[model samples]
Target: MHGGTVRPRRGWGGVPKINVYLPDDLAEGVRAAGLPVSAICQRALEASVRRVAAIRRTALSAHEDPTAGLNQFTDRARTAIRTAAGRSRAAGGQLGTADLLHGVLDEGANLGVRVLRALGLDPAALAAALPQRPQDPVGAASFTATASAALELAVTEALALGHDFVGCEHLVLGLLAEPDGSAGALLRDRGADLRPARQAVVAALVGLTRAAPDPLHPVLARLDRLERHTGLAP
Candidate 1:
């Protein structure tokens, strides 16, 4: 009745809502952009919090905090991206988001890739979808190796669906896309419903509203940093 209350709404998840305030100019910006003010505010706040937490996570290795570990993941990932981009430039090719993703996947030191492997993804399968790297007359550097067709398709799906980056959820969707692929077969074998799973991820990505303080809310902010760090999005 006053500010937006967490009324049990009708939907797949019965999501909750929170009330907030915005300045006149901010409200105008939201209106001119044809956006939901509450959602925009929530997203910005979430992103900021995540960025701080992620940086902190990387700075302090001794702390066993979950936030610490998550930030470390991003830190390691950014480092790998920079290294791969250097390789690509050395070979004369411009680095791109796909290139960065390939770098992340190839970085044997990171636990993110390991987590994907544990979830039944065969890294080799991704290789099959890789696009031919740009070749300079002088043989510009090779940046990202080709991903599997399934992996490419997954990335394509995320882009087509208007997502800025291919996160873990997108990877899961990609795995599901490959029915005959290793990850797909594994998920299916385990009785995982790909459609529902995808929907759930989408819901989390879209409808799951959050306030500034939640731990997981920072995922978007961390993603923004990743985008800039990897040269994924300007």
Candidate 2:
């Protein structure tokens, strides 16, 4: 990382070596911090593999409806997804993250709405900020790559949350987590950063509110950390 050689790490048998390039400053920083680049890369790669596996199970083909096979997501989330599909169809395009955001806002009763409000996001305003599309129609619509990726992240989020049921909140997190999506940017612009939004989600689901911090928060956090450490986390 400095004047010394950066060598390929030795691992389990038959594993190939590959170099991970880093900026001079960042490499120096990592050296100074004593961070293990190989371990970091391995963990990240493993997580990515898990995420890809999850997506493949739910992925729709070219001719498949974007809104179809969404029974894995909650009923309310499915309804909102219909709104997204309709919006995409009316716009004469593939479903996108923007449309997904609308799906979160289509139903006022969605837990996603309350979760956003809890994070100080105005759901109504967020929906209004997106391009308006006709809401009446429900049809099979393909999804943009961005939308597909976001939905994939939604599944990942549900797994991370240890949730058997994928909810609207997970979709909200997915929209906010998908780096290439404008919907994620919109949420971040409204201060819905991934970490806090995730915390807000946990709190909301467990009956916590903005009024005060839940006493169970620390316990939950510890348990979550333990879950990851035990390799039980997704």
- In order of appearance, the predictions have TM-scores of 0.32, 0.63
Q: Residues 42-158, candidate 1: write the lDDT tens digits.
A: 665565455434433332112222223333124554554444454355456644444544555666555435544555555555544444444333333331222244335445445
How do the residues 125-179 of candidate 2 rate in per-residue lDDT, one tens digit apiece?
A: 9988887777545444567788888888887787666565678999998998899
Model 2: residues >4 Å from true position, as ranges?
1-67, 135-140, 208-234
User: For model 2, how big is the CA root-mean-square deviation?
Assistant: 7.9
Clashing pairs in 2: none
| Candidate 2 TM-score, true structure as reference | 0.63
